[model samples]
Target: MSNEFKDILYEVGENAVRITINRPEVFNAFRLQTVEELIVAFQRANEEKSVNTVVLAGAGDKAFCTGGDQKAHLSEDGLYGPRGTVGLPIEELQTAIRDLRKVSIAQVQGFAIGGGNVFATLCDLTIASEKAVFGQVGPKVGSADPGWGTALLARHVGEKKAREIWFRCKKYSAQEACDMGLVNKVVPHDKLAEEVEEWAADINQMSPSAISICKRSFNADSENIRGISFMGVQSVKHYYMSEESKEGVRAFNEKRKPDFKKYV
Candidate 1:
């Protein structure tokens, strides 16, 4: 295992590579450097011949990740920048998650909120702790866009549930997420690592080439429609940057609920 200052650790063992988010102080909140490191880790895992499967987990007991670093996102001028242009560079993180060829699993332990939830859903499979809580809190934080979260959430839980999650910023438990098909499995906190390792062992026993091909096939089918939908949704980001979104941000920063009633 290799340790780093940023919120990432890379380890290779027993035909599997494990990447852990290492910032427990802030609930493993993402910084821009963390995204870059994760990209590097994913590339390394993809290129390594000895690694047949990849696992993602967060360090500590509290949270997998709470999402973007709000303090990091606040500029010296005190303004929130556009989604990918600020904080953790979510687009790059999403691209890295999307590029993993080996079977990937997210072993989520606790809070998986906002961009954190997006990160977990990007994996091929998710094994969550029974105590974990997941949600998209961007809306509450004054962000109009959910980044790549919309794509994966809609695919996993369908459009209505996805809309409810993002629009309402409601938190759901691991069991609720599992019942809604957002997670593959939920195990006790103590069993998360063991269960993930067992699953990875089974995956590692498969023919690497065959597993890679199967992953690609399923990934393409799963993402094709959502990709097109994302393109369309992304085109409207400029609208999110307009006065309405600015007002949303301002209202949030001021600790008052937005007055969108007039727009309604």
Candidate 2:
């Protein structure tokens, strides 16, 4: 499975399948190809009878994921590479994680920012290492996640903290995240894998069908999520394609502060 993916690492475990974003050079920031691969990997995990859980991580200690790859993002074509025309692949991937019957765990180590933070939030549980950091870099980078990034995040951390996260683009430590109810647990960096394995073992001992039903029940707020996310996604699509979006991207690439003071 590792040989098949160009942007990710897939390994089937005794009771779980571990999917790690492989692009560590960029702090594991994802592009269109990466999200598509993740959707397939999670779907495969959902189908396997022996697989009672799915574990998500990233390749390096630098970042679990930094969200969209700002270095080369072109917006419209990201959902399906350079050909397809949609920017909602991450949105689709979020629903996949939540809707799957098997439990999903985000084993975050570092830099789960912006959409990356959303991915971790949408999972049934998140276990972070002491080194992990969570926040949103979207507004600073010409983007935002209206999906799990805001609404669902508020479900975990409450409205005020969620707003602080997205609006300020500030970083939160692993302990800070756990304090806000954003993550289930925070382990020492060296013990992360063992802790996650223990959690997976606990999950594997549960009844699959019951867990499935529970996940569905938890996701009953889907209607409101879809409505809010639909508007957010559409708004961002236009924002991503706008001249302001290009200026932000250009400034990021240039390693300077985006002079947004002149925009409005």
Candidate 3:
């Protein structure tokens, strides 16, 4: 709602509100505060009468978002500030995006990895730049999004492709992502912003009430994933406490491959 956010930039334009993660120093990685700010921003946009579309983006050219700030999650007591089952309130953030009556678009310019990938998956449509790279790194990092990040993603790209994404943790280029049904369109890197604005303008010309009902109708099919997200995050919280999970983080910070097999 407020434009004075410490971790993100919220701007209201003609008929669209853009929320950009402003943490390029850390690849736009989200911490507790970042997630909280995002939730508030999305909620604000949802309430704004003049807004017909919400554009979710990240600052800088290097990344759209790399996911959770692992450094902030290092402390065992407060994983990312003890706000939710996983200490990130990620479920709430996801729900905020899902429940928004306005059409949501992911303006991805660079890396959309880990939780970032989930955000892209959750949006109503995704417009990517030619430079974008998309993937999941949860298994590699000793974590996994058990709900919408996984189940909803499967719906977008199919179960087998989704499994390959999560299990293999490989990065896909923008064209590859578009080919797989993940991205709606891919434009030149320099034209990314212009492309998103055009799409938003087109959406704004449509009937708001019709769009709202259509969005709700589409969401109804996957509404059950919300419940799955709740319970799955609880399980993730427990998994975070395990040595296996910690190993992943440690290995990441130490710049080495995790020895998850040893834990197994």
Candidate 4:
């Protein structure tokens, strides 16, 4: 029922598979190994016949995930690793979740910022705790999601609001996120797990084949965003090498505000 891995925990339950980001010490931020492990876990759930739902969560109550580990990325020469474009296999991970047949749910109990916000958005359903906070920090961090993180997000919360989330980099409460259509439900912090289970259980009762078909049909609409992501990622690769980007990382590491304008 449980599979072991560093950075993350994978477990199979009644008809659902749970993948939890386990590095709460850094607020569950992921590094290269973490994303790689996550992809593998998602693939496992995809191939499992009995699994009807996949739950993505973060360990501890502080954060679901805060996006990529800036500290790790900094140590790796400004890249997450030598795996994918932009130094992380982000596109593949996003594809793995989007292309997954079974319903995927984001069980958010705390902060879901940066790429974590993207994860919550991409999930078929997002159930949040009352204490949850959602937002994007790509631009603020001298990085950006470009593709699914932007285009797909616009589809969820609308262009104006999506721009506010990315450009402003401000946080929103669970109710605010729900009202904006980023989250499906928001419950008390302690009841988050129970609420997610009930939602998963309800989903489990549906016909799997039907669900899969509907999921694909829905995806077909915005599939073009994948191309946008490809182009954007290529641009980001170059951006990462710029002083502007490095400044962001430097400021974060130094616990100071980034003087990005000076680099411009």
Lowest lDDT sum, 10 consecutive residues, model 3, at 73-82
- Residues 1-264 of candidate 3 have per-residue lDDT tens digits of 555899999999986899999999999999999999999999999987886999999999999999999888877652667688788888889999999999999999999999999999999999999999999999998899999999999999999999999999999999999999999999999999999999999998999899999999999999999999899998899888888888888888889999998877
RMSD of each: 3.2, 2.0, 1.2, 1.1
Candidate 4, residues 152-249, lDDT tens digits: the string is 99999999999999999999999999999999999999999999888888888999999999999999999999899989999998888788998888
Candidate 1, superposed: residue stretches over 4 Å from native: 76-88, 144-147, 225-264
Error of 2 at 27 (Å): 0.6
By summed lDDT, the worst window of 10 consecutive residues in model 2 runs over 77-86
Model 3, position 80: C-alpha lDDT score:
64
Tell me the tens digit of each residue's lDDT in model 2 across 131-238.
999988888977777776788889999999999988899999999999999999999999999999999988898999999888888888654886788677877776
TM-score of each: 0.85, 0.94, 0.98, 0.98
Residue pairs whose backbone atoms clash in candidate 1: none
Between 2 and 4, whose TM-score is larger?
A: 4
Q: For every model in order, what is the number of clashing pairs? A: 0, 0, 0, 0
* Model 1 worst lDDT window (10 residues): 76-85
Which candidate would rank higher by lDDT, 2 or 4? Answer: 4
